[model samples]
Target: MTQLKQIKLIAFDLDGTLVDSAPDLALAINAMLVDLGRSEFSEQTIRHWVGNGAEVLIKRALSGTSVIAEDLDEALYLKAKPLFNRHYSERLCVASKLYQGVGESLAALAELNIPMAIVTNKPGLFTQPLLEQLNLARYFDVVLSGDSLARKKPDPLPLQHLVEHYQLNIDQLLMVGDSKNDIQAAKAAGCASLGLTYGYNYGEDIALSGPEFVADSLETLVELMNGSVTA
Candidate 1:
C-alpha cells in the first residue's frame, strides 16, 4: 500500500463504508415494489445496487438490474420515488447496523484529534438520520450528502468542498470508501484515497479501484493513522 500523504482531514463514505444499510434498504425497496405491484428482489441482489445513491438505487430496482436501462420509464420512476422515500423513512434504522470496529475506530480517531467529515453519495434526508441512528454523526463535523452540493462523488465537488471548508491543502485530505466512485473522486480532487475490501463496490474488488491504500477492516485505519493517515 502507498503511504497516505500527511492527512489532516479524513472524509468517509457512508452506506457501505460505515453502515451496512442493505437490509433496511432492501426491505424498503421490496415494500415499494409490492406497492407498485412488482416483484420483490432479495437483499443480496439489492446490495449490488447500493453505493450509488437513492435515486439510482430506485432506478436499478425499477429496471431490475445494476445496469439501468436508458429507456427506464420516467412516469413509473416518478411514482416509485415518493413511495420508496416514505417506505424507507418508516424503517430507516430498523435493520441497519454499523460495521464491525466502526464505532471503536472512529472513537480512536476522535481521541487522536484528527478532524473528520463524511462525504457520502446518499442524500441528506437519509444520510443524516442513518448517522444519528448509528451514533456516527458525533465523529464528523462536516457531513456532505449527495445533494449537499450540485455534484456528488466521481465529480469531486464534495471532497473539494471539504478541502476548502477545512482550509487544508489538497494532499492533506483523505477520502475513504469502498467504491470506485470514492477512489475516482479522490483522484480527480488530487487527494489520497483508502478503499476498504468489505464494503459495497458493485460486487467488484476494491483493489481494482487503485486506491492509495486498501484494508479489510476499518480498524486498520486506526492503526495506519495512529496519529495520521500517513507514514
Candidate 2:
C-alpha cells in the first residue's frame, strides 16, 4: 500500500460512491422503456450502466446493453433523452439512499473541519434533488455536476476547477469514487484517490484503476481519512 498522507479537500463522486441511486435510476429507465414499448431492464443491469451520467444510462437502458456505438441514431437518442429525464426527475430518491456508514462518515469529516465537495457525472437536476432528499447536501461545500462544466470526469476539468476555485493545493486534495472516470480524473489532476470496492465499476475490478487505496466500506474510508491507518 502507498503511504497515506494528510488530505485537505476531499472530493467525491455522488452516485455510486456516496449514494446507492441505482434503484431509483432503474425505476425511471424501466418506466421509460415500458412507455416506449421496449423491454424493461433489471436493477442489477442498470447498476452496471450507472456512474456514466443519465444520457449514457438512458442509452444503455434503451439498447438493452452497455455497449455504446458512435453510429447510433442521433434523432432517436435525442428523442429518448427527454423522456428519461422526465421520468427520472419524478422518481429520484424514491428508492435511493446513502450507502452504509456514509452519513456517519460525512458527519465525522465535518467534525474534523475538513472541506469536502461532490464531483459526479450525475446532472445537477438529479444530483441536487437526490442529495436534498437524502439530507446529504449540507455536507459539501461545492457540488460539481456532470453538466456543470463543458467537460465531465476523465477530462480533469472538474477537479482542476475545484482546486482553482477553492484555492486548494492539488496535492492536498483527495478524490473518492467508484469508477475509472474518477480515478482517471484524479490522476490527470495530480491528486490522490481512494476507490470503494462495493460501488459500481462497470463489471471491471477497481484495482486496475490504480487508486492509492481501495476501501471495502465507508467506515474503513473514514478510518483512512482520520489517519487511523498507518502509512
Highest TM-score among the candidates is held by which one?
1
Segments in model 1 whose C-alpha atoms lie over 4 Å from true places: 1-5, 227-231
* TM-score, cand. 1 vs. native: 0.96
Report the lDDT tens digits of candidate 1 across residue range 1-231: 434438898999998999999999999999999999999999999999998899999999999999999999999999999999999999999989989999999999899899999999898898888888888888999999999999999899998899999898999999999999999999999998889998788878998888988998888888888734444
State model 1's lDDT.
Answer: 0.91
| Global lDDT scores for all candidate models | 0.91, 0.87
Q: Where does model 2 exceed 4 Å of error?
A: 1-5
Q: What's model 2's TM-score? A: 0.96
Query: Any residue pairs clashing in model 1, and if so which?
Result: none
Question: Lowest-lDDT window of 10 residues in candidate 2?
Answer: 1-10
User: Distance (Å) between predicted and true CA of 61, model 1?
Assistant: 0.5
